[model samples]
Target: MVRRWQPPWRRWSVRNRLMAMTAIPLAYLFFTFLWYAYHSRLSEVREELAERGPLVAKVLADSSEFSVIARRHDDLKPTINGLLRTDPSIHRIDVLDAQRRELVAAAARAPGGTAELRYYEAPILKRLMWVAMLGPDGKPYQKDRPAASGVTVETIGYVRVTMSPSALLLKQTRRFYVELLVGSLGLLACVLLAWQLAKGLDASLQASMQALREADAEKRRLIGKVNTAVEDERKSIALEIHDELNATLIAVRLEGQRIADLSPEGEVRDKAQSIIKLALGLYNSGRSLVRRLRPEVLDMLGLEGAVEELVRHYDSARSGCRFDLQARGDFSRLEGDIAISAYRIVQEALSNIVKHARATQASLSLALEQGELRIRIADNGRGFDAALASAGIGLVGMRERVYALNGSIALETSPEAGTLISIAMPIR
Candidate 1:
């Protein structure tokens, strides 16, 4: 699965991916932190009010007794109003009698729609005959007496207080808004940072890839130039050996024959004839050697005829082997190097067939299509595995030469089957 996806991603340059990889996590981490912090802090603010609501209600209950028993509705305001002024969290307060009815309720400020309310109740218990007493400092104190000692006790009322949580949460909302702002800005910065980092990384890698491609092209060209030079030198050496050395040996043989005809029919004439024969042998051997190095017919008969001559020579030397050549288009008009490379490829392929194919017949085809020179050589022989046979120096050389010409070569073969070598070279 990974291999299947690799090629498509390669189409998007390296930089874009790197930036996305870098920025996404940072923005995600920041936003997650912001989300967690906002809810957690907001919960804390709400909890503070939830815990404090009951405390504020209980405090109001403890002090509401005098206002409730006196039935002074106007007097209940002062007690609640003082506490409201001290703590802003309690937005409203109410003192009710024991009947669960409204008595005196006071609000320092109206609770908004979103504000929460809390209720607390405290009971007022009746006392004995001496209900209250005064201390030495003239402060009122509660005194309790038994009801059984001719004392009557009566129930008074209850105090109910109401509280609001809006005032306590107002300040926390401001801090939460600030956190949201910072988190948004931080997320933007992370995206920008990742984009820049990806661009830088991609640019460097692309530059390196281009440099490597150019270097590889240069190496191929250099190798091609060297191969051309070597071939030229071989041609020059072959022509010199075939022309100069062959001529000298032939001239010497003619001179020896002439000397033998003028001599008497004795040991001297026989020795002269032997000399002529040896010189003639040397001349023939040197000519053969030159032809093997560089086929002279290539310059005379052109590419096609030269190839046929090679095939004919091979057929003569090896019995039970016939080479059939089929051609389309004019090979003689092809570029010199292209033609030579094609001939050499065919030569090498035929050599492999003779040395290894173990077949009686081989077929070679040359065709021109869409400005490309196509050559196919096949042999009906006991062929070896193409994979294993490719390790041979002959095939390697053929492949290298074709590569230098910017051409392509392919081989098809299996054990006990025939072999086929297909090549294509642009004919320009």
Candidate 2:
């Protein structure tokens, strides 16, 4: 089964393309905006954590009730243990002195100095750096050594905190990118629809133009029929005049001859001879007129026979010039209309050859080869400008006939070179 095509308007359009272009940048900007917003939100969360973290540490450290009851305030012992045990927001917390001794921390029996320092330095210190930066009042806690020389001296103690916010921001940003990409794609689809609508309009206009051309061709065909009818009528009238009037005139001339033989040496005989001469010239002129109207040989014989006859007639009639006719391959196999058109072209060509081409020899060739019928009329005569002669009615008529048969005609001529008319008609 043949599938029906959708109408042009139904197909994709330029609006779609334009929308797609805008959507790409819009998506990028949207994603960037969301990324910045998510980052700002996370940074805000982390910053709040930084400021409030120290306060939480201080409260745990200085709380007198907890220090007395838990026995944890002597060093910030209760602060570190309470923060780590309760709040999940805090990963780990450590309280250290200026001497790098662990003042308080969970998971150890006594105060940790060197061994605790080694443990915190590797994992705990690295984690805390992201969650907070030390304030001016907070002491510089040496991560590796308890008392390395050349370090800042005017310090007391510090509380360290560690948290995870990078993973949190990444999860939120991924959601925003997905949403932004989807929205951009939706916008692109809308634009595509609009563009397709506009393209449909252009396609319809082209269809209308094609219809108009077809209508014009039909009109031309009708016009051609009318023209052929008028030509047929004129030819019929010319033939009637030649046959009817000329036959009667010939009969009268014969009767005049009989009377002139009986009365020789009289004015009657002289007048009779003059009348006969006049009648003969009139008959000759009538014959020429009939031939000009249409060659009878074209009707009596087919194209090939008529063309050969015309060549022979021209050879005798115009003895000053030589006309050669050659045929190769099957000329008889050509379509009737094509053959007739070819013959007319040759007739007009020879006429021009005699009239303008001041040459002594002209040749006509007709052949068929490789599915194309070829006709060539060439002369060894002074050639004229091809461009100028193209405007001539004879050449134009030849072109029209050739065009009707889906064939082509070309004139090959230069000033010194002879004129050559070549026609190629596709036969298969």
Candidate 3:
């Protein structure tokens, strides 16, 4: 099977993902606000410059009319200098006569080559009034009858003001920078808050996981105790059957034999012989049951010997199938629980092979290395689907026994293929 690729963010922990979700949108909004603010501030500064420039020129032009008419341009310099001193936006002021001749000019210090300059012009107007008066002949001269009062307005000179927008822009830039800094700080604060939240959630998740692990461990320990208790009870029953029941069977057989020998050749003698044979068969059956409940070879010869004996029994019983056993390392130092569980696991596997595998050949391998016991059982058989068979009593019992000892087991099998069962148990 091929695994599909996942985005890098998918691998992030819940905490990190949450932080990213919160921060990304906030960052975008913050930058968008800054962009709008920058443009809006720039437009406001430009508008202010436009309004201030034209107004300043009109005022200067009105003031300079008399100075330009009298040709006493020097008189206007003081007013021009005063206006320049009062307002920083005004870069230069010029007074020009009607003929476009420079009369007097006053310019503020150059702001720098990079300063943006704008020009505004306002025409200085002169008003003249013509009144009809008696001529030297003592009569009003009537060129065309004297019109109603004659007043005429004429442009005398111009006032041109040069305005620099650098000051306004600089002020706006400072404000913009401050706003940006504040926004950046706010974003940083949000990220920090997210990090703290994530940390808390992660801690809680870890605590939950730890509790679950402790509970599982406790469950396994309980299972181990139960298995041990069951085994102990089985041993007790086996001992009772071996010492008490077998002894009674032996006594019955001996009495039957005695009756047969003493009785003369008749139906009674034949009945006694039949009784003796029946007793012997019952005794043998009882022995086999005792062995099944608790194998004596396990205690006498340890795990390896017990397993070997079991294999031999199965091999002899099923002539059509062959059984093999391979062992490594010492089995004598194994703990009782580990030894018993391992033996049961192997027993269950072999039983499954015989009952369901329809196997012609099977092999069991055991190894003890680095404080761990490893066992493998394989068979050349018509295997069944492991998933379907997992719920079977035999496999479930094997799995529970292995889990009770905190061991691991893996099963590999498919239809028409051999089944392989592998287990690893920590002996220490």
Candidate 4:
């Protein structure tokens, strides 16, 4: 079972969704605040207008020749004109008579009212904001922006001052817009900063995960190389012991047998037979050691045959122990690496059973279900602590090997219960 590595991008992502999530509310709230502030400033401007309106009216009325009708009317125009010039913000200085006839419309010097002017007037006083109608006072009137108190009495006429915003209002509006622009920019900057921060954090985590994966791969490569080298060394030593040493022992045994055949049935003959028996035992032990160093059956006969031969050897070597071995499902049909990995796990488990488990019987079973291959080795021995075994390096090595092949191993054992080792590897 070979597990392919997952790419970093596929594993997790933080950037895409966060930008939209953080940006929306910030923009909405900022615009809402600006809109409220804009209206508030306009209302304040109207209040300022209301405060200045009556003063202009009072000044004009006081200077007029009230006794003469034509002169008073004539006299009023100059006063209105002077006021208009004093504050260039004054758009139109219309002195309307009580009958609402236009006694004076200063802006008559320019073209008359357009539709835009009517729209401007529409929201003026009726919305409780008549004072705001003054166009910009241009410059001078800022110190004394007219506020309509509705304060004129004798009421021969009413003055309507439309301001082109006073310099102060103009400056304030500019400042407000500047502040609004700055605030919006600040908010956008904050969102970008947050996104960058999140992206950095995600990248750091991804880098750490990549480092871990690389380290794991490197460790596996080193372990595999080292294990292969050890096996090669073992094979070399086994060949030396078998081909050179074992042949000498066999020659000595044959010499003893020849001597026994020649001698009579006496003490010398019995000693020769004993020497032959001891030499044969030594040869068998040497053969077993050679097999342990590198099982030739594993390379030549495939995994299942090697396992069956190993079980038979174990059964012969340890006569008291009963072995129950079975190959279930398509055990013969597996990749060499997977089969070898499974074989090693079984070998290690059986070795552990023989060494640690003082058991009467042991069983080994393997099966393939779906795409996964499962191997189980159980013993009815006096079990040790599974926790300790799991924590130990030997068991950890076994598990690491399994993991390297993209498989899993589980050992179930306690002081009371017998040991059970199960491994599963995906073959497809």
Q: Which candidate ranks first by lDDT, i.e. highest? A: 3
The regions of model 1 sitting more than 4 angstroms off are 1-209
lDDT for each residue of candidate 4 in 255-363, tens digit (9 for 90 to 100)? 9999999999999999999999999999999998988887778777778888998888777776567777988675666876677667777787777777778788999
**lDDT at 202 for candidate 3?**
83
CA-only RMSD, every prediction: 16.4, 18.4, 16.6, 18.4
The TM-score leader among the candidates is 3
Residue 144 accuracy (lDDT) in model 3: 73
Model 3, C-alpha of 160: deviation from truth (Å): 58
Each prediction's whole-model lDDT (CA): 0.77, 0.66, 0.88, 0.71
Candidate 4 stretches with Cα past 4 Å from truth are 1-199, 263-271, 299-301, 312-323, 329-338, 357-362, 369-372, 379-386, 412-419, 426-428
- Model 2: weakest 10-residue lDDT segment is 119-128
lDDT of 3 by residue, 1-428 (tens): 24679999998886888788888899899989999999999899789989998898898888877777788878888888888888887888888888878888888875534456888999999989987566667788687756346889999989999888777787899999999999999988998988898888888887887999999999899989999999999999999999999999899999999999999999999999999999899899989988888988999999999999999989998546799999999999999889988988888898888888889999999999767899999999998887787679888888888888888899899999999998989998
TM-score (C-alpha) between model 1 and the true structure: 0.53
* Whole-model alpha-carbon lDDT for candidate 4: 0.71
Encode model 1's per-residue lDDT on 248-318: one tens digit a residue. Answer: 88888988999899999999899999999899889888888887677788878878888898888888876
Candidate 3's TM-score reads 0.55
